[model samples]
Target: MKHKTPLLDQLESGPWPSFVSDIKREAEARAKNEKGVDFQIPVEVCEDILGVMELTYEQKRTHWKHGGIVGVFGYGGGVIGRYCDQPDLFPGVAHFHTMRVNQPGGKYYNTDFLRKLCDLWDKRGSGLTNMHGSTGDIILLGTYTHQLEEVFYELTHDFNQDLGGSGSNLRTPADCLGMSRCEYACFDTMALCYDLTNEYQDFLHRPAFPYKFKFKFDGCPNCCVASIARSDMSFIGTWRDDIKIDQEAVKAYVAGEIPPNAGAFKGRDWGAFDINAEVIDLCPTKCMAWDGKKLSIYTPECVRCMHCINVMPKA
Candidate 1:
């Protein structure tokens, strides 16, 4: 049966990308497949998912009913229990649960690995996934209670992977792609992340802590991973010594020969670069000064905030 979702359909008309559109597309595909071809999830499940969501929109409240503590055997965390309140109307989504699969270090994966993972989820899950959730895990969106163990086994045995932490356990540790791509990296963020995850597998796989914990690693002060703001334990790399200055590059920036902020603002017409206003003035510690041609930095007062180095990479 075609599910009428007028309220949810309104979300598809705007300029922004809508998840409603994606779900509708999946629902349509599943509906057309008469022979139940492929490992695609049932069309009723997709339709019921839309039905439940539309009900919530119409009622201005959630229709999800939290189930009791539930997870796969031998693992206390990773699986989250969710049940729809209107089970009779949406039985296909009645036991909808979520599984958090631990992503590879730095999220590196080959095509074979990804295809196998998708195939596994398609066979056992609702076929919805978050590429990488906030905690840096692959979120497998909807499955039944009975299929949890089989899904976990296939993940571990077939895919050679495990689940990420949830509940009171240590959440998945995430790190920026450090030495692999970033030149500013002072340490091996991915290596450290891998090592720590293995060292604390017990804590990561079970609810051993009173409160939820997290670890995030950033190779340099740039903190592309937002380690400082989000993680309970943050590892931010920084150089303790003085920053080496390149006089020729500094002159190049001053002469408008080089773009500021490593050419990040190249598209915008920000006019000429100003050393005193852009670099020195923006320095949090106020330890830098530019004397016409030369840039001076007091070593002791420097907090190594990286603003100067980021602005003048050559210097």
Candidate 2:
């Protein structure tokens, strides 16, 4: 039988997709003794999770509480303790602690690795996973307090994986794909991230900081990882060298024979390309000049704003 969840059902009515709907679908499927493509989490766990969510909405406050040290032996961080206040009403979530697994640099993963990791969590956790948390750790959401040690031991011994940082410890370091895929990347971001993570294992596992500290590395000025805005320490790759200019390609762009951004906007009719208006005029330092037949760049004053390169990619 489907339990009453009027508040949660209301979330499914809007245009935006809702997680409540997905959880309810899983709960209903489990209630009917339906087998799941992956290992099935107990139906009661899902229902209780929904029940607590409904109660939270009804009460206008959380039904959860947390405090005190809760982690595996020798490690002082990584596991977050969570408990339900209404244990009698929602027993399944009474000890739904969260664990953070340190993700591989650049988040590279194969199907076989993921399948095995998921199988481990399904057996010991609530079967929900967030690819990355706010700090870029793989979030293993919900597990019993008693199973924490077992999960950690298996995660380390079998998978050769470790937990990320939490509390006042140095939070997990994150990095963009960089040279792995992007042409603009100036350095090996993944390698640096891997080195730093391993080198500072003690700081990552122990609460030595006054507050949480984070490190984020971006391959180039693009800063795809949003390091500047989020992390305490940010590394953005840059070069002192000037950008190369192709005179013939410049003329092609100027004459409207070649598309801007290398025909990236070809699918849409965004009007003719104007190098003077788009590239020269938009330069932050105004270090570019076009004289109909040739293009000139004042490399000494160039800021590497990438405006010229962005508009005339080939040039």
TM-score per model over all chains: 0.93, 0.89
Tens-place lDDT digits, model 1, residues 176-217: 999998899999999999999999999998899998899999
The TM-score, computed over Cα atoms with residue i paired to residue i, of candidate 1 is: 0.93
lDDT, model 2: 0.83
* Candidate 2: tens digits of C-alpha lDDT, residues 106-211: 8888998899887777667776778889899999988788889988998899888899999999999999988898887889999999999999999999999899
Regions of candidate 1 where Cα sits further than 4 Å from its true position: 33-41
- Please report, as a residue range, the 10-residue window in candidate 2 with the lowest summed lDDT: 34-43
Clashing pairs in 2: none
Q: Tell me how many residue pairs clash in candidate 2.
A: 0
Q: Pick the candidate with the highest lDDT.
A: 1
Task: Score residue 283 of candidate 2 by CA lDDT.
Answer: 89
